[model samples]
Target chain A: MGITRRSFLRRAAVVLAGVAAAGAGWSYLKGLAQSANEAPDQAASLPSAPVQQRTPQPHHWAFVVDTTKCIGCGKCVAACKEENNVPEDPHFNRTWVERYVIDEQGEAYVDSPDAGVHGFESWPVNSKYQNIQVVKSFFVSKLCNQCENPPCVQVCPVGATYKTEDGVILVNRSRCIGCRYCIQACPYGARFLDPNLRVADKCTWCYHRISKGMDPACVEVCPVGARMFGDPADPDSAVAKALRENRISVLKPNLGTRPQVFYIGLDQEVR
Target chain B: MQHLTRPVLLLLTVFLLLGAARWAIPRMFNQISFAIQDRTVPVGTLLGAGGHANVPQDIEAWKARQVQYAGPASCTQCHQESVAQWKVGDHAGVSCETCHGVASDHTANETPLPTETSSALCTLCHSTTLGRPSSFSQVKVHQHAGEATCASCHNPHNPGVQGLPTDLIRPKPSAPLVQHVVVAEANCTMCHGQGRLRPYPQDHAGWQSPGCLLCHETGPTPTLVGASATLGAPFAGLVQAPSVPHVTDGVPSCTRCHDSGAVRPFPQDHIGWSAGVCLLCHQAGPAPAVGGTAVGSPAAGGGGDAPRGVSISTISADGLPPLPHTVVGYTQCQDCHGSDQFRPFPSDHQGWEITECLLCHKSK
Candidate 1:
């Protein structure tokens, strides 16, 4: 039978609408399946393992770096290596010191030799910068900011990296796909791929040490008291007092990372 | 089956394929291992309720990781002596485990801990780097000491100090009792003269065979043990200078430590005095009458006449005897006042080097 033009057009339109609805439903289900892959269902199975005992008042851990006080001795870096079992390679520093040498001409020269493990002795090794008359020079120690609005946590596709109730960002090694997404997302460049573990690794502020009522290795070894760590929950804590009293600044204020690490004497040139 | 045409059958096949692909696609490509295991593995059977491997969220699991360093507090119980030494040293601020790695395992298993004593280890902190504060003691590793191990010259326990005075000289194994009956023609000075295999002490310059017999008995080596122990009194009689009361564990700088507002600051006359001059008169170990006797008194002087320039009537503010002569032009302090020199320095100065003369005895 010969079909009428009007009837033929109506049938084609109905078929196309049905196909579009099916496509949308299929994509929605696929998204759910992918999310199921990310959030591991094992949370309910493990009963014997001790979880962090939630206290009445959750701790808000904070770190303060006093650039004025840092001598660039690198004792913190050395101690971090011993405490964290960080690889001996110069490239794998969880925390490092950067020297900012600003000359009278308004040029900034920055260098971190061996991640400042051996200290800043013989710094400004570049012979070209040697003769430059410098107006200001100081050491700025850098570590994971453990940001409140951590881009790392937001970017982890597999829900592997998470922020704890106590405010430290930790990575679940089991679930990480080693995609390097979170590493790139970090604005402060704190994240790195752990060569040995094949996972995204960054500083946890020595989680093992901090949880047990001990200071982080870097904070413990700093002779000049350049690094400070404490719970802002406690009013009398040094970190809280410093944050309240000192003119504090963070690594990247414009990025809105809301970093828990505050710095005293932060220069405008520092990124 | 008869009613089914090519168009109708093809449409049914396409719908079935689309349904299958939607179900299988996630399982095939993505990490749906946990989702698959969630159904098969019963809660707490093989893969726990989470149906995944361990995650660091488990605080206990995270804590289970091996801890190497036990911290400084762990060593204090057994290593009291080293702790005490370190407390007084320039390295007092440094943690013991910084240099000594992974001590927790050692504490648990009694396994031997590695002690890094190489110069390279010292250079880790002490190498003259550009950024280190000038207040910290640092040096150019290559230029400071040519291939010399830091511990060779400086005591690692207290790096600021040098090796003890006793390390330089072995005590005189009291003269071999002559061993045989001496004849009238026997010449003791001839055999025991300077540069001889058994050289006599420089203090016995003019002593002849008879004078030696006064202190040494002519016999077949009398079996009197503990004779050297009793020699402390006689030795004090020979040298009237006061002895250092405290233990001198490689004490290189007496004034650097004692010159400050210490319990017993050095006297005014001793301001520019060097170590050689101090050692020339003062003995090691302890003074004979340190607690009770006054300076330069008969008892303090070991019941002997005070040496020239040292008088019983002259006492400085600290009650020590005043220097008899100006310390100027006495740069070669060991020449006239070294251990067993012409005038003979106290026995403690026996092994001291000429360079150590200025450490304590700076001339005004």
Candidate 2:
């Protein structure tokens, strides 16, 4: 009984169909496992026990200035420059305050500089727009809004940028491939490419101070006590309490980056 | 079998190709790129490049013309007083560009460019803290409710002296007699009982007594008896040995004993029986007699024989002095007068009293 050509053809087709069906089954199972393990809704509900249960370690954390409280003092910017040894020509690892004033007639005036230590002098002026009776003014302090669900983490192929257990997002400079994905993914425009290191950099939340049980440079030297920091999971913590007591909002909620930084008393004029 | 095998092989190849196409098609179409100066680059870079570097050089040239400016030094010159104060302030080192928008305006304008400012401008630098001065009012409240400007409490010019006044008020001290007791428990009740009353027994009466304070009310215990009582001595007998010995020597009489260079005498011109010496012989007995006429007398009727013809002059009660010795102001008297003279003075006199004078008189 020699095998017929038709019989051989049928057997080959059956083997191919079986392989395809198996591949489809394997794919379906892989997706099911992923869904079961990392359900988005369940991830959101995961107990933030580390923040809630443990004794709060003293940390020199930082805040994302809401642009509302910012009086454009630039005290933070100046202190950061002096403390961090920021470059003179093109400032490195520092922040500055920006002032935006809008008149009732909808004229907008904006001003900023690379630094702000001497003090803002050109305020209390009229807007560029005409017939503006009322003026809405705000000072936005620009810095990193260390996000919990940082898109920078996802895009970093080398796992250089990571979220610490204390919820601070930091970059292991040694591991960074200098791919500025983290910088681009950040909505607050916090990260920047360090010209000297040729790698992406931003505020470190003063990790050195935090390790030694002192406040970050900006928080320590702030004249008016503006930036606040603490574990957001603990209800009694200042950052958490502030969020609870006041009407708070984050920047660019539509992007789905779960930013831990919060702002209070935000004005419509602020971008 | 050969014919069947050929058809089957062709069909299997077709199926594999179809499956690969399904997976690869969407990803290939979704790939995006951008054109830069007629050259192609990733769309990501084209969108991410900030306008500062991305815009054409011609556009940058045009934007530079519209820049506004103001110098921080202009304000520092006019506000010298504030600058001097700000020099010492915590925010002293901060530069002008920090809070103000920029200086392009002042540079462009022949006249000073008008600037816009608000409390919101201050919050850019000042924010809240979790510890120490916990709840900071928002910029709106700080400006409106506190009626304060950044310069009001802080001097941006000098950054020193901050907002604190140079001449601060100093608190005045209370009167001497008023006796300000910081720790009331340690100073007040330990000496004077509740309501400043003397405990009991009129024999122990002193300046601090309820009776004496009725007239002489405004002074610390002045007399030895009064001083001892104010310091809570058990009895007058205990007054000779300093109540607070760690603070001062046992001598209680200020004037009688402390007159310039006079060496205090014992046994001869001593006048009073020393309670310190009495405590040496009569270790556990009741407090021995001190400074009165009855002291040093033999205990009635021959039980302890009195030494022959020893007439010791007792200390006076009305602040008068006892009779002076012929050898005036010597610390010891018996060196000149022999043991026979000491025997004549008093028997049963414990050896505790200083008897040798020459032992201390070699230099004299």
Model 2: how far is A264 from its true place, Å?
A: 1.3
lDDT of 2 by residue, A39-131 (tens): 554334322212112354643243534444445556677666654545554345456666666666777666665545534543333223234
The second chain of candidate 2 has a TM-score of 0.24
Alpha-carbon runs more than 4 Å astray in model 1 = A1-58, A122-129, A235-247, B1-60, B140-149, B152-157, B160-364
lDDT of 1 at A70: 80
Task: Score candidate 1 by TM-score against the native.
Answer: 0.50
Report the Cα RMSD per candidate: 20.2, 21.6
Candidate 2, residue A162: CA error in Å?
1.2
Model 1 steric clash total: 18
DockQ class, candidate 1: incorrect
Candidate 2's residue-wise lDDT over B59-152, tens digit each?
Answer: 2221122211122344464557756655665656454444543443333333453544565555444432111121333233443336666545
Give model 2's DockQ, 2 decimals.
Answer: 0.05
Residue-by-residue lDDT tens digits, candidate 1, B195-281: 344633444444332233233322232221233223333333343334443332233444433443222434344445554455333
Best by TM-score: 1
Per-prediction DockQ: 0.11, 0.05
lDDT of 2 at A220: 49
- TM-score (all chains, Cα) for each model: 0.50, 0.36
